[model samples]
Target: MRFLNFPFLVYENILKHLEPRELLLFSFCSLKTRTLVSRMRHTPTYTIFILDKPEKMSYGFVEKPEKEQILLSWTWKKIAMESENLDNRTRLKLKDVLLDCRVTFHRKLNIPTLVCRCEDVSSRKRFATALHSHMCEVFHVKPEMQFKLSLDYMDELPYTNTVRDVTFLQSSVNSTVADEFFEKFHVTRALFSKRCVPDRLLKHSCKFLEIKNLFVDWSPWLDITLLLKVKCENIMFSSSTSVANDAHLIMDNFNLEAWDPEVDKIEYDEPVHDYCEELLYFLYDIKKYMLRSGILRRQSDGSRALDKTGSYCSS
Candidate 1:
């Protein structure tokens, strides 16, 4: 094509003006185009967001506006029927897997997107991994992956330990599925959930844990033992019923020596109950007891105190 014949610096400037979707489409034209696109000096960092149900993967800059993003979706429905209807669609080979790729505007979002339909369920993981690796190479960015997973689709888990953040959607998951999921994936940054996540999974250390909408109607899904078992740097509980009893339990049984050293903070935001007063009291008593026993020493500020675990217990 005439566009490909342009001077190297000339076309490089032109490629910089194209949006992510356009750049990706141009890269698919030929090997030289792909190389040229990859060689661009200023490439936007992309985060891969994966959804299990209605399985699809989307890539875009998290800070950018919604319309600027590009989505690559996969669907299993009407494969035989749709393939025959579209004449412009082509098969793009990603490693060993061949994807039936077509460019179409998203129905609801109305943004240009590449829709790929894999041949079988077994090939989905391979296709996703290949696409992730290809984008990383083409964009010269490290993978920053996130997943919004449904327990119903546990069999479709992403590449293990590659995901940075994971949000578990509410689903009736069996023990077997839960075990397999925890065994396969280890969340690095955070875990967010609105369901009764398995206790075994909570034992995995993460940077943040946020649980929402789980304590409605005084559900016993969350308790002191479970809270103590969570090995996270920070824990946030929101939209829950009163956790006054749980707070009391922490005061009684919380052991600095046995507690996970990684745990630095725990936050609670309850609509029905405000336990800040109780938490303050609990921290005060713990500080007094620790000071009496020399487990904690007061600083010159007379406000902050550090425990033997090197964690600040501030009131």
Candidate 2:
């Protein structure tokens, strides 16, 4: 029992030393330990997908001292769902610990990339609401805490139940729906604060719009261009149909250059809401000025022109 006399910080550090997977199991043994582990895991962790590596080397091989240039070891985070084995007492303890940990270590929680595949918009919205409610309650915070909740969706719409901030939704569903959803739900100015509007939108209004990235591929979106400026890192036009052929004439459409990520300070338009200064940059913007220049001439011999008018704007 004397060991229990040690400071909670000591216990926390010990748990921090455990592998992430191990922490999940270790959390079950006691109320205090579970709390410590939960606090340690709140901050978002990151993972970078690597497409190419040396054929003969494993990460361990690269780390071996024999190799002069060692590749950095990689780490990532995974979220956990409720497990039924824990009794209500243990469950309550775990939840309490997580709540306390979230507040005590607010800056440490990892922003998670939520992979949602729900086809129903209502279901997705419900999920966001549930996620928002649980986190806010667990942290004993207000709805504002939802801003800190960052997510990334793989092949899923950004709006499931509703549109929330800082969540990335990637999907093959028609871009038309995504465009409409953002117009209906997301705050354009709040988006601008994070520099969320892309240049294509800026060119539309001829004002400085901040965006990290933006995408529009259908007609209804054109209606909201006035409200949809983003200072995004990337701007994508999935289908030019959104802007009528004549409208495209007046509008400076986004190209690969639209993909370049925006780098700027955060600023919000409203008085009550808050914003986060991103501690890191994860996505890259790709700009495609040439493709938007309206010149479609190719060489007679089937080779792309070696040179054409360079980008008219700066990324």
Among the numbered candidates, top TM-score falls to 1
- The 10 consecutive residues of candidate 1 with the worst lDDT sum are 210-219
Instruction: Give a tens-digit lDDT track for model 2, residues 1-315.
Output: 453578878766776676443444355456655455556544332111111221111111111112222111111122232364222211212332221111011133321122222234434333334433433333222343112111122222222332223222222233343344344444332232122323233233322233333333222223323323334433333222322343543244322112212432222222112221121111111142323332221122221111112211111
Query: When superposed on Cα atoms, how far off is each prediction in RMSD?
Result: 9.5, 15.2
Off by over 4 Å in 1: 43-46, 52-55, 63-68, 79-86, 107-119, 157-161, 172-176, 194-220, 239-243, 246-248, 254-315
The true-versus-predicted C-alpha distance at residue 260 of model 1, in Å, is 24
Choose the strongest candidate by lDDT: 1
lDDT of 2 at 239: 26
Model 1 per-residue lDDT tens digits across residues 1-315: 999888888887888798776776677677788889888774555465545455454555443212225446555543554556588686877656676767667778655555655446666666667767777888765676656566676555445465555566555555456556655665555455533554333334232233221221122333434444333433333223233434555455553233322443423333112213332344345446442112211232222222321112222
Number of backbone clashes in candidate 2: 57
Off by over 4 Å in 2: 1-10, 20-31, 38-172, 183-315
lDDT of 2: 0.29
